[model samples]
Target: MAMPTIKAVRAYTVRGGGADYHDTQGYHWIDDHIATPMARYEEYRQSRRSFGINVLGTLVIEVEASDGTVGLGVTTAGEIGAFIVEKHLSRFLIGRQVTEIEKIWDQMYFATQFYGRKGVVVNTISGVDIALWDLLGKLRGEPVHALLGGPVRDELQFYATGARPDLAKEMGFIGGKLPLLHGPAEGDEGLKKNIEKLADMRSKVGDDFWLMYDCWMSLDLNYSIKLAQKAQEFGLKWIEECLSPDDYWGYADLKRNVPKGMLVTTGEHEATRWGFRMLLEMDCCDIIQPDVNWCGGITELIKISALADAHGKLMVPHGSGVYSYHFVITRHNSPFTEIIMSAPNADEVRPAFSPLLLDEPVPVNGRMKASALDKPGFGVRLNPEVKLHRPYAAA
Candidate 1:
């Protein structure tokens, strides 16, 4: 059995809800008055869009094999991501063996190391790395999970990230994580409101159902401690990404100061093994939430997961559609997954990357069967009806 060689690599970008879930059009809850770091400024407080959260759009990467099978990867880098793929990263994969993913990933990372260690640069590499894995899965005629070792669990249980945890509770999720709506700038009154909101949701969902807050990197150390202390009364399961991902020391201190049973988690914005190394070694968090799309794809995720597992921490990934699904089902450290409710009201389940991917699976009653992911590759196709713009082309 011979493996296929990479034939061509193409990059494209699209707008309005795809891998870049933030690049949506409408009055969705994700873009609502959710608290963010930019909320300190009164002008940008109302909507995250005002701060350009959706400006990047969606980056789509396609790696075509010699046998004509094309593997796809999507992320939130948009046109800038396409430019990196077409002008810089493609050179690493153009003529290599499709199975030579490790070498290609190494080259892509180190080659762009000077200017690209994190942010959109790593995002582009992540897209490329994911595409390579998808290519390998298709070439091998197995799902990415099977390629990664095999499933350790029979199904994936999910915790919903949305505004309506009450609704999610009715939907059968293991838990619901709400976006914290007030930051330090809002003062004590805002802190009171934050507690009130949690109390309200707890009243609806009751005690046993897991409830958590996603601060979205919108709090300072003092404010985070205050919120966590208040949230403990409602039986909050965890406080997530409360401070900037760069604040490792702050995260460690927050972890130490948090209520006795509650967990302090972060790392969704951090990237690579090195970044996670800083988090784990410092004991900055109880769980590490890496978004597969943003955390250097499954290739780096494997390394990060191993590190976390060794450190006795959980690798609970952020909401990334099938890319996270395939990886989640296979790892022991990944006990459950996170799904971002896309509907405006979070009442109905929508594909995480809706309108961009066809045949994307949504959990039934907040649970997805492992059997549902039996298809080759990542088990979804690009929605051809969606427009993909190629911002740059390889010569």
Candidate 2:
């Protein structure tokens, strides 16, 4: 028997909240006065959109096999990612065997090494690599988990990330991670309000609900330490991405300065095994949170997950819809996964990448059965009604 080869690779971009969850129109909790690196500047302090966080939009990649099976991937690189896929990365996929994921990934990475290693370039590669995995799974007639090695557990549990942990509690999540609303630029009053918010949520959800703060790379080391120390009274379970991804030394120091038993976590923006190696080797964090969409896709993620497991660290992937769900169920170290409640007020559960993906599964009461993902490939389809723009093409 012979195998099918990839025939054509296509790329498109979408606007307003798909994979680029920040590219939204009306008020979204994610874009609200959440503390971020740009918050230091008074002009961009009110909303993440002011700093053009949503400029990239969502990049959609599709790989069509010779057998007519097509695999899909979505990420935040938008039109720039589309250009990379069509103008540059498409050659690596077309005419290759569908099983050549690893080879193709290597080629894409090193070929774009000079201009691409992280950021949008790596994001493009990640999207293409993810499409390959989805294509392979469909061709093999198995769910992605079965292709990976079968699920270690019957279902996946989730923790919700949003502004309203109390509502998430009512929704049955194991834990609720709140976005930090204040930063160092706000001074002591900002820090005080930060603790006050946590204190209020604590009082609402009670102490045992497992509350944590997601600083979103907005804090300096000193301010993060101050916030963590104050949050200890509310039994803060973790403090995430408080500093820039490049600050390994600061992360290590923050890890040491945090209250005993309070976990320090980062890496939603970090890419590749080499970048993660720095985090693990430096003892920079207690757990690593990689977004499969942004962290080199399933191909590199498998390697990154192994590295964390070997170092005795948990790899709780960032909230990335079904992408995180498929991989988390197959690993022991991934005891639970994340869901960034996309509901306007975080008052209800909604598919993380809503409207862009059809048949995309959302957790029922904070748990998703392995069977929900039993369909071939990633078990979801790109919503045809959602307009797709092809900005570049290969001749």
Candidate 3:
């Protein structure tokens, strides 16, 4: 039995998932002068044929081992990730043993430090890091959770993130997290509408099932606190990413100001342990939600979770398909998991990354049995029918 050496690293830019595939109905990323909520902007943009939702466009990375095992990973980096993997990061991985993940991660991070400690660059590193984990899991003939010290719990309970908490309740999810449709620029009426929407959802879902808001990094300190204070009457469980991920002081202020018993959570957009340290040390948030794809992959997540646990905070990773599920089950601190309800109205349960992932796991009655993920590696493969565009190839 010999160790498998990485032979090549390839990046695939994949497209096509029909009209409903993109998660574009949330926040708008453009500058404030032109920025508007996605819903309002999308209609006009569509009419002009000048823009379309490209959020679903994915950059998938495949790391091939000398023994013919190919491990798969994906991210939101689009073509930029493809370029990083094919041209830069691949050099660090091409001949290394798959088991040297930490060393490889360090080299990749430091090598790219001058240009990338976060954002698309970290996203690029994430895709590669995940592929390496998938590779190692396959070589060892074990599921990723087993490699991460096995499950601490027998099953994973889930909450849904979508438009309809009522539908999520019917599907047996423990809670439903809705997107805040407006931001600070929307004014006082917008704040009223935000609370009104939560109140309406609270009336529908009733008092027992938890309801929370995914503010999506779109609120200011004053607006978030106002929204949180109003939302408390409706039993909001937490205000998530209400302020920018970088606003540690604002987060700390919000945490202190929010009505007691309502938690403040963030970090879905934050990257690396150093970034998360600011959140934890400042007592900025009660819970930390790191997206594995964007938060430096599972390697960094392990470190982040340990830090959260040390601080007595919950490490509920923002949903990223089975990648997060595998990590969630292995840790005690991650009490539950999140499922991105794919049904247009959040009425039906479907794999979050449907069409993109073959053999993807879905929760049964808001719970995922541990046995469901028993397959080797991440237990998933790229949907063969989907076209993968390899813009760059290693030499």
Candidate 4:
């Protein structure tokens, strides 16, 4: 059989689930008087329904091959990704072979360098790159992990990222990472409350279950150290993204300052190998968390992972649905995966990218068996119920 060539690339901005989408922006709590990290938590505790999860939406990418096999991918890019895909990226991919992923990725990167080295441009590239991977997988009749060199493990252990570690523990997740609500501007009281929140969670989940904080690029070096120091008393597993992704020196300093046992991790916002090279070479973090969707997709993630492995750093991708799962199961260094608790109160273990993906695999008893993802490509489809807004259609 002849290899299938890429026929067209399509981008869609889709409105996913209503309440359960978990928009990160909606969680930001800024109060002048309250002035504490726990303010958001307290607010959430009091009025869960009032803080409605408004849809920030998603960008879905579809790559069609000559044989009519369509492979799907998605990201948080929204209309921006759709524009890039339909206007700029579609031209490079339309007549190329589906197997030319690396070359295509390079072309996309260099072509967009004037206007796009990071941020939404990389995100747009990521969606297209993932679609290309999916396209190739379908054309070859293999799952993505198998194409990446087969699974090194039989099952993938999971940690949850959400508001409720207690609920996550009950659901069989190994650990739960809570988002840090207050930034440096909140002052010393906020720092105390941040530690207090972790302490409260520790009391509920117990010391045996792993507990971590996702600072979400909201803290300064001094605040992070104080929080980490206090967190040590509660046996906190790690402190993630305490500073901006660009602060390599700060990360190095924070890594050295934290308690001996705890780990320092970052890079959920950083992109590509060059971005990660700074993290590894600076010896800034113990673990690197690259989102496969945001960090240039599977092709770039492989490169990023290899660099982390070379440096003896763990490559735990940020929770990005099935896209991360396939890559996690295949790599020895990844060790485990992350699942974002999509339940309203973070009380239930729903599929990570719920209502957006039709057939996403959820972890069973804190683990996803390899069999769940054995289907060709990424093993999921875009939910047809979503209202897709195609910004630009090719001729």
Candidate 4 error regions (>4 Å): 17-56
The candidate, 2 or 3, that scores higher on TM-score is 2
* Candidate 2 clashing pairs, residues 3+ apart or interchain: none
* Model 4: per-residue Cα lDDT over 1-395, one tens digit each: 77888887888886644212434333322112222223345453322233442333578899999989998888878776788888888888988888889999999999999999898899889988988888888788899999999999989999998888888899899999987755566667767788888889999998799999988676778988989998899999999988888899999999999999999999989999999999999999999999998899999999999999999999999988789989998898999989877765677778767677878888988998999998899888876776778888875
What is the model-wide C-alpha lDDT for candidate 3?
Answer: 0.84
Each prediction's RMSD over C-alphas, in Å, is 0.7, 0.7, 3.7, 3.9
lDDT, model 2? 0.92
Per-residue lDDT of model 1, residues 1-395, tens digit only = 78888989999999988988888777888888888999999899889999999899999999999989999999989899898999988899988999898899899999999998899999989999999998899888899999999899899999999999999989999999999898888999999999999999999998899999999999999999999998999999999999999999999999999999999999899999999999999999999999889889989999999999999999999999899999999999999999999998889889989899998888999899999998999988999899988889986
In candidate 1, what residue range of length 10 has the lowest lDDT sum?
19-28
Candidate 3 residue runs with Cα over 4 Å from true position: 17-56
TM-score of each model, paired residue for residue: 0.99, 0.99, 0.92, 0.91
TM-score of candidate 4 against the unseen true structure: 0.91
lDDT per residue as tens, model 3, 1-395: 98999998889887644112463334322211221224335443222112443543678899999999999888878877788889899889988988989999999999999999998899888888899989899999999999999999999999998888888899899999988866666678777888898989999999999999988676788988999988989999999987767789999999999999999999988999999999999999999999899889889999999999999999999888799999999999999989877665567887767778889889998999999999999999988787878888775
* TM-score of candidate 2 relative to the true fold: 0.99
| Poorest lDDT segment (10 consecutive residues) of candidate 2 | 386-395
| Candidate 3 vs 4: which has more TM-score | 3
**Candidate 3 collision pairs:** none
